[model samples]
Structure formats: structure tokens, C-alpha cells
Target: MKLSFLVLAGAQLGGVLGLWPQPRSLQTGSSVLKLAPTFDIHVNVAHAPSDLEDAVSRTKGFLRNDKLGRLIVGRGASDSAAIQHARSLNTLQLSLVHGSVVKSITDEARLPLGTRSEEYTLYVPADGSSATITANSTLGLLRGLTTFEQLWYEYGGQVYTVEAPISITDSPAYPYRGLMLDTSRNFFPVSDIKRTLDAMSWVKMSEFHWHVTDSQSFPLRGARP
Candidate 1:
């Protein structure tokens, strides 16, 4: 039914065809939706994180600037008229609410330091208006965005398209879902670690255990890693 790669929402994100780790509950529909070039991202709650905007920007930028998939555009053209014509687009509203972020951490929205709740619900309306990602916290929102990225694919020499009228309810089965790397036995560069962390975030991993210090080696000693 398809011919080419979907030009990827981003290297670190996933979509409908292959939502990483798979949500607990998911239901899709027959209708399809198109993401306009200037689609907006809006949050419901007040005082959201700075990272939220940046993350959304990076996530959506992949669709706008196509590097390889330009069959629709002529060889020397700077932009795609098909994409630009739909500048009047609807916003992808993010309805983010606060839940019990963590049982241990008391104060509200200790975003950077503590383990926050990561449960989220994604809704794409059948009528194709105000597609929303509802979540209990910013952490949950991050997870929802990752799943949203995977839903889109390049359709008929075009990009930023997805099957709409879908709903998903997702949460980690275990709070301590984690991945540990035994770096004590081997040395890893910062670039390698960054890529690994991105991959971890894509799968919604709760923790990463960098086993840096063992009896024999201390690669991350005496300096910040």
C-alpha cells in the first residue's frame, strides 16, 4: 500500500505505524488528518516548562524541512506550494493537567529533580479539529508527543499526514522501567551517551543507570559527565 519512508517526524520520535513500546490502550479510525506547515502547539495549564516548547518545535520541524523527500517539489524549488497553501491550520492543543507527580515528592511541579508522573491520553478527533494530547504532567506530555510523532507518514508525494479519529490511553506498567548500561567494563563517549539518552526518552524509559564506577575502572571520575 506504500512506497517510501515517511521522512520521519524526527530521528528520536515515533508515530502511529510504529509507536514505541506500544500504548496500553489504542483505537484508530478511518478518517485522515493533515498537519499544516504552521500548525500551532498550545498548552492548557499555566506555567509549563521551557523544554515543552522546545521539544514541540523540534518535533514538528522535521515535517516542515524535508531534506530527502521532495518529489512534490521541483528540483531547484525552495519550498513546496502544497504545504505552504495550507498555512491556515488548526492548533494541536495540549491539555496538560497535574496528577500526583510522585508519592514521595511533596511540593507541586518539582519538574527537574524528582520522578514525575508519566501517564497521558492522546485524542485525534474524527472531524479533524483541535487534536489534543492530554496528560497528567509535563512528563506525561513528553511521552504523548513522542507517540504523536509516529502517527504521521508521507502520503502520495506529500508529508505531514496521518490517519485521524484515534484515541490512546497509556501509562507505564512499572514505575521503575529503566535501562542500565555497564560503562565500568567499557568506556563510552559523550556523543554515544547523548544518542543513548535520546533513544531512552523515545521509548519512555523512566530511568537510566550508568554503571560508571566499578572496582577496576573509573572513567567518569574527577570530571563531569
Candidate 2:
């Protein structure tokens, strides 16, 4: 019997090393990425769904906001600046496209037949010429965008992402990524419910089991035919 621990000399652990529910694979190369202030999102599909468009817009809004406290994955960037002097680097933009990924996560990617998978692959070049997030469905694109934002942090009044030339391929380990709320027992306000759903979507939760009815109370209206 034997055990071995391979240590990453250049890489650190925790927020300093990765994201929450870290990707199944995250390989980092040398260099740093100074995220563009106008870091925009573009969809490559022929006709992006309205919901997908809306998600991309929202992702664009939050990705460049220095005020967003969610980019705490790798906290202190003071000493990690790749380029000390503000030199002209390529302005990187996020591009999302439709694609399938069945490697390693074949079961999760294909199970529950006809399900819209939330599997995605994100690649950011060390040169910073561009970045891309590819997924099999819109759900996957959303997750990719969330991971993109988490890669950035504010340091010395500049937004940057360490560990450049990054490649991440991830999918849910379990098929049921879900959340539930018993509105029949304790109804959350419509606005509050919406906010909760939005947060869940950001975290890439695929299902929301809303308990709208129970033996004690029936609170939801039926859908119109």
C-alpha cells in the first residue's frame, strides 16, 4: 500500500488557487491577466435565445464591476501583478458558443436523456488575445460566465486575474443540481422568490423544486392553456 501527494510549487490553495466548487480540471500557466474594463460578452450561436441573451448581458454587467465582492477566490493580488507597468495588452472579451463535451463526464453530460447539460470548457490564453467559454447548452454558458467572473480580483486599483493561460473543463458531479422551497407553508414574496432563483441560476443550479402546494395549502395558479 502506498500514497503520494503531488504538490504544486507555483500554485497555492483555497481562494488563492481556485473557485468555489472548483472545476473538475483547472490548469494554469505562467503570466497574469489584466481584465479589460469593458470586458464584454458575445454569443456565437446563430440565434441566441432571449433568456441566453439576457444572461449574457447580466454577466457582462457584473464581470467588470470592481464593487462586486464575489471575486474573493484569490484575495490578495498586490504581489501577483503580472505586468507592473501599464503596457498595451490585448483587450480580452468573452465569447460563448454552443458545443458538446462528453469526455470524463460522459454520464453527467448525457444522462436524463434530452436534458440541457450545464457542462462547459473555458480557456483564457496567457497572451490575453481573447477568451472563450464553450458549452453544450445555454445552462452551460451561464455556468461558464460565473466561473469567468470568479477568476478576477481587484488589486492596486486594477482588475486582474492571476494564473493566466487557464483551461477549465467542468460539469456537475451529480445529475440533480437543485434547490427547493416550500412556498405552501411559508410563502416567500414574489420579488424575494425571483431573487432567490436568480442567485441559484448564477450558481448553475439546474432545478428549482418549488413546493407550491401541500395538504395544508394550495398557493399557486395553474398555467393557462
* Predictions in order: lDDT: 0.64, 0.65
lDDT string, candidate 2, 71-101, tens digits: 3455554434454643223443433442443
Clashes of each: 5, 1
Measured on C-alpha atoms, candidate 1 has an lDDT of: 0.64
Error of 1 at 212 (Å): 0.6
| Stretch of 10 with least lDDT, candidate 2 | 1-10
The alpha-carbon root-mean-square deviation between model 1 and the true structure, to one decimal in Å, is 7.6
* Model 2 pairs whose backbones collide: 15-73
Residue by residue across 1-225, what tens digits does model 1's lDDT show? 132344443322333545678788877764445665557788665665667776678667745553333233453143344344422236778765655232211222244434467778988775547878887766677788888776655544445443357789998877766889888898788899899988887787777888988889876647568
What TM-score number comes out for model 1?
0.71
List TM-score per model, in order: 0.71, 0.72
RMSD of each candidate?
7.6, 6.2
Query: How far does residue 175 in candidate 2 sit from its true spot (Å)?
Result: 1.8
lDDT of 1 at 106: 21
